[model samples]
Every structure is written in C-alpha cells, then in structure tokens.
Target: MATANGKLLTVPEVLAELGGEVARSTFYEWRAKNQAPKCIKLPNGEIRVRRSEFDRWLESRTEEAA
Candidate 1:
C-alpha cells in the first residue's frame, strides 16, 4: 500500500495499486524492448526504480497525447 506521501514504491506495490494491469513479466518485456523505466542496478543485480523518474515518464505520456 502507498503511504500518503508516496515517497517510495516497490514493483509489486506499483502493480498492486494499479489493479494488476501490468504483470511482472511486462517489466522484463519492456527491458527487452529497451523501454523500461530508468533503473538503478545494484552490484547484486537488484533493480530499484526511482519514483520521481517514473512519474516523469508517466507524465510525458500524458503530454504526448495532448
């Protein structure tokens, strides 16, 4: 669940709050397509996406449609 400020969100947290519309596999698909969100890759290979960058990406989609 998101906090009131939404300072951080995990992958599942994002998918769950969005009603499971995008599956975990889709993240991989986007990566394969070179369209995944800006991700930080840890030395152990874990990925952490920044909420602000993601929101910017989301907002750009809206601007494109305008």
Candidate 2:
C-alpha cells in the first residue's frame, strides 16, 4: 500500500530494493540493537520503514565504509 506520499515499502523490501544483502533476521537483530533506520509502528503492530530513511541510512553506511 502506498503511504501518504506514494511510498510503498517494508523494512526487508527497502533493504532489498536498495541492493543491501542483509538478511531478515539480521535486520531484526539490528533493529533490536537500535542500529537500524528510523521506523514507524502502526496500530496493527506492523513495522514500517520509510524508503527515504532507508536511503539515508544506506548512504551513511556507505560513507562510513569508505
């Protein structure tokens, strides 16, 4: 489903869409450690990570790795 601004992505989807090979469980682990991107928890208990936020996170990681 598209968000208010036409974004349609989940955490794993965002990671894959960005060409990140992170595993689903690993992503959850990162989230547990507060090391993942910013996110929103909906009333249905679903986690949603914004595409823009993930992009920024990926860019930051790339810069850090450089």
Candidate 3:
C-alpha cells in the first residue's frame, strides 16, 4: 500500500531485498535500537518499512572505499 512515504515493504521483503542474510530477530533488534529504517505499525500489529526511508537509510550507511 502507498503511504505518505510511498510503497511500503514487509519485513520479509526488506530482508530478501537486502540479500536474505538478515534475520527477522536481528532486524527487530535493530528496530528497537532505532538503527533500522523507519517503520509503520499497522492496526493489525504488522510492521512496514517505507521504500523511500529504506533507500535513504541505505544511502546514509554507504562508505567510500579508500
């Protein structure tokens, strides 16, 4: 569904897009620490990660190789 942040991604989709190395528990741990992309908690209790926010978060973590 399109949110204010545009397309929303499920946690599984996000993990798969990240190459399937990150576990749900790990992602949740990062979320609790405010280290993962910003998420939306729906009425049913499922979480959604905004595509734009995730993109921006990925950009912020980019490193320049020396």
Backbone clash numbers for all candidates listed: 0, 0, 0
Local accuracy of candidate 2 as per-residue lDDT tens digits, 1-66: 667754657866866775787778887898899888887888997788877777778688774434
TM-score: model 2 vs. ground truth: 0.73
Stretches of model 2 off by over 4 angstroms after superposition? 4-8, 18-20, 64-66
Q: Which candidate is the best by TM-score?
A: 3
lDDT of 1 at 44: 81
TM-score of each: 0.66, 0.73, 0.93
Per-residue C-alpha lDDT of model 1 across residues 1-66, encoded as one tens digit per residue: 233544555667556755889898997688779676666666787665667757766676664434
- lDDT-best of 2 and 3: 3
The deviation in Å at residue 13 for candidate 2 is: 0.8
- Per-residue lDDT of 1-66 in model 3, one digit per residue for the tens? 887658999999999988999999999999999999999999999999999989999899999999
Q: Model 1 segments beyond 4 Å from truth?
A: 1-8, 63-66
Q: Alpha carbon lDDT of residue 3, candidate 1?
A: 37
